[model samples]
Target: MSYKSHTVLLIPGIFDRGSSLLRMQRALAEEGFDAHYIHLRYNSGWHGMEHLSSQLMAKIEKLVKKETTCTLVGFSMGGIVARYYLQAMSGINRVHKFISIASPHYGSYWAHFLPYKGGKQLRVGSEFLRGLNQSVRVLEATEPVSIWTKYDVTIMPHSSAKLEIGTSYEVPVILHRLMPMSSKVISLLKKEVITGMG
Candidate 1:
């Protein structure tokens, strides 16, 4: 069977070893899309979002063909990693669609407990996020989409998942970490990736 031209790169969230995204990958495969996910080298993001983003860039460079664009589906902090690549690493030009699921685009209160460069950057008013928020318009080149749940405890004020530059969908999923594996979220992804709907 012929697969879709654009690849769907699944970037797992913090603490995700890889299995978190298997269901999504399987769904995409069954739908005839090219899907791939690698366990991030800096899964904890201790080094910083840029470091994690660089790793994503390298994988993209190796996996995607020059003729093909990619669709990025980042879960939680994985979303921030993808944004760093898009806004700072010039990844917007290479993407056809950008999707962030349960990501803290506005920073998370829960980040206060995690004392690390990556966690600090995820705080409510970090310079890293400030810089990215200012230029979120860049993602407009690709059809940017945000998926979040109202019950997300990890984001502490789940509205943080609503981005300033994209269409936001509120799924009824209960937990933040389970978003990528939720059938509702997966179905939403399929719709967004295929239709780019508003």
Candidate 2:
């Protein structure tokens, strides 16, 4: 019954080496949770979403064999990756909860403006991105919690930060990257994790 025994998989956002979640992971560990980080490499390249989603699914499959249950803590694009994995892969059933911080559940305007070969792949208006958002909405309906931030700069048109059917929190002062380390964000995550376990 010790929730601390559950492992937390920390997925980092676009172009992030997973270093972004290090402080938060350590803090979670201090609170008696087992935390691990996944560094997604193709957040800015062609097929970035596909590549990361496949990698995350593989990791979840591997973890399912050893852990009874897990929680996914995804940041920004990482949240999209986690949602896709849960929806498309069967390994996600082993997960007990999901927590997203500053994630673009509905796609982001920044992707529409970025000048890159794969930039269009992230556009909120793109057919692919819109479809992915729909899938995430369905997943949120069945998951424990889906947290978001209102002051995110990366996911402009802040509405992109919302999920369909879960508790949504709006922290008014933190930016996108800073969310993973913000005290308020951490507290929210801690509360969600505890609630999920209970």
Candidate 3:
């Protein structure tokens, strides 16, 4: 596909008021690329990970048409949600590039306090995470990229942000929430977006 046809779909973290990723969306748009920030109906994920992913699939189906794929930019819980769409919802066949920022791919200690169904899934060693990890190779064709910070407190063991598959970048950003807005992170993301268009 041509670079002009490249579309980026950005998914925000859990419990978003729906504007958490506006800055990232604008950055992509300012770069002259087509980008959309997808808001989840159940952002708090009170239902569960599967339910959140189902919502993601529906939004993606509306945005991406047959024979055309888009790059996905997911932050925090949104990253895992996007992955469920890719790994389990057959989204891998439709998505070419996967970029996750400050996501807890390996589950997070912070989730221990979350009592919601979706929150429970984010806890360390949850069945949901283990299942996703087991089938992560499904994303090999997409050459996933994970961006994280060494100082993230939201995701305990900060190393949990690093993916076991594909490329991972550890930026010097100070916080997890800042990953999507940091200039350094955005610059690298721009490069990744442009490169995959080839």
Candidate 4:
């Protein structure tokens, strides 16, 4: 059977290994979308978001060479990584759709508890956040979708996951890490990607 022209890449949250996104990848495959996950060089929170974003960009570059279109499904910190590549690194041209699940687009209060460049960047009002916010318009070139849970405990003030330029959804899933595994989130993500293709 001929596959869809687009491929979906899954970026996992901070400290999460690439394998953590297996459930998401499987869901996308079942929906007839080619899905893959990147093995981030650094899974720790010690590096800056830019560092992680660079790795993600490399994967996107390689994938786009084979597929006509690409979609990014970032989980938690993975969303931030994709944003950096899209907003700061001029990745909008490479991506057709962006889906953020439980990400901290507006910065999270708990980020201050960690002592690392990446962690600090997640704190509210960080320079990284300032730059990301300023380039929010870049996302307009591609479809953006923000999926978050109201009961997330990790991203305090979970509303930080919402984006100004995209459609937002709130799920009843209580745990932050379980978002990708939630069928509701996966279904929404598939709908967005397919709709964007149309």
Candidate 5:
């Protein structure tokens, strides 16, 4: 269970690219950790979760061949996707730690308000999110750490961003979009990473 040399898979939020997580990936690399970014395509009308999850699982399978343990760094919707991957996929044994930043562990209120052509079908936090949360809660409780932010606007009601069990970190001032690059947030994350790895 010594986690010092484990590979970290960084997953980005919704409507985002791998470049969004580049800074953090570089930071982790600088710390002498193996970091990989999962780039998912948005605007596939939200039906891309299966495809994206499959891609992630494939990458993880490859990593498992080399390492005994891995860590997942998921932000926002990417956290949800990570949860789904852990719950539904059979290849999650390689993941030793899971850290979520500003993710909607519960359903988000803003998702109900956003106007999309496909509406609830095209976004998270609808009935799908509610069910996803229930499932995630069961799976996440087995993980080592689950981090959250308090001042997130993207996931309204703020409470939606909390984890029901496991060690949760609540940062007071950072917003959702800035969570990836904030120095304070990165510092907090490094601490959690060390804690989880231990």
Candidate 6:
């Protein structure tokens, strides 16, 4: 598919408003790509990840039924949610590239700080995260990329952001929330988006 025909679906992190990804969306649009931000109502992690992923699939289905498969851009919890859609809900066939920014692929210790059903699920060694890792063991069709910072305070052990199955990039940024908006990060992402279309 040509880069012009490519679409990007951006998902925000847990408890984060979709507007958090506004800068990235606008950057993508300005680059001549059809970029869209997904607004998830149940922002708390308390809801089932798969349930949320299904909701995302519904929105994805509505957007690219006949068009080229989209590139999935997920930040933090949003990355995990997008992974659930890909690994558990057969989303690989619908997406050409998968980019995760500062997501906890291996459960985070900081998750224990939050007191919600979703937080419990994200805690280190939670059944949900285990299941997610198991599903990723068999992932196919789409190429996955993980982007993270060495100084992230949100995802403790920061290393938890790294993935074992696909490409991973460790950046020098200091905060987790700024991953999506960083110009350096955006440059890397733009390259991935264009490369994945091939």
What's the TM for model 3? 0.95
Candidate 1 per-residue lDDT over residues 163-194, each given as its tens digit: 87768899998888789999998998998887
Q: Which pairs in model 6 have colliding backbones?
A: 45-118, 46-118
What is the lDDT, from 0 to 100, of the residue 111 in candidate 1? 91
Better of 3 and 5 by lDDT: 3
Writing each residue's lDDT as its tens digit, candidate 4 over 1-198 gives: 123356888999988887668877887798788889877868665878889889888887787664365888889989999999998887877788889999999899989988899889999889988899998988986778999988998988888998988799999998988898898997898889889788
Off by over 4 Å in 4: 1-4
Which lDDT tens digits does candidate 3 get at residues 61-134? 78777678889988999899999999988888778899999998999999988898988999889999999999
> Judged by lDDT relative to the true structure, which candidate is superior, 3 or 6?
3
lDDT of 6 by residue, 48-123 (tens): 5776788899988888765458889999999989988988787777887889999998888989988877788778
Error of 2 at 139 (Å): 1.9
lDDT of 2 by residue, 45-86 (tens): 357566788888777667645546678888888887777777
Q: Count clashes in each candidate, considering only residues at least 3 apart in sequence or on different chains.
A: 0, 0, 0, 0, 0, 2
Query: Which candidate achieves the best lDDT against the true structure?
Result: 1
Q: Each candidate's lDDT (Cα)?
A: 0.87, 0.73, 0.86, 0.85, 0.68, 0.84
Expressed as tens digits, the lDDT of each residue in 1-72 for candidate 5 is: 423345888888777776768888878888767889876755232564556677778878776554476788
Candidate 4 residue pairs in clash (backbone atoms < 3 Å) = none
**Error of model 6, residue 123, in angstroms:** 1.2
- The total of clashing pairs for model 4 equals 0
Worst 10 residues of 4 by lDDT: 1-10
Off by over 4 Å in 2: 1-5, 115-118, 137-144
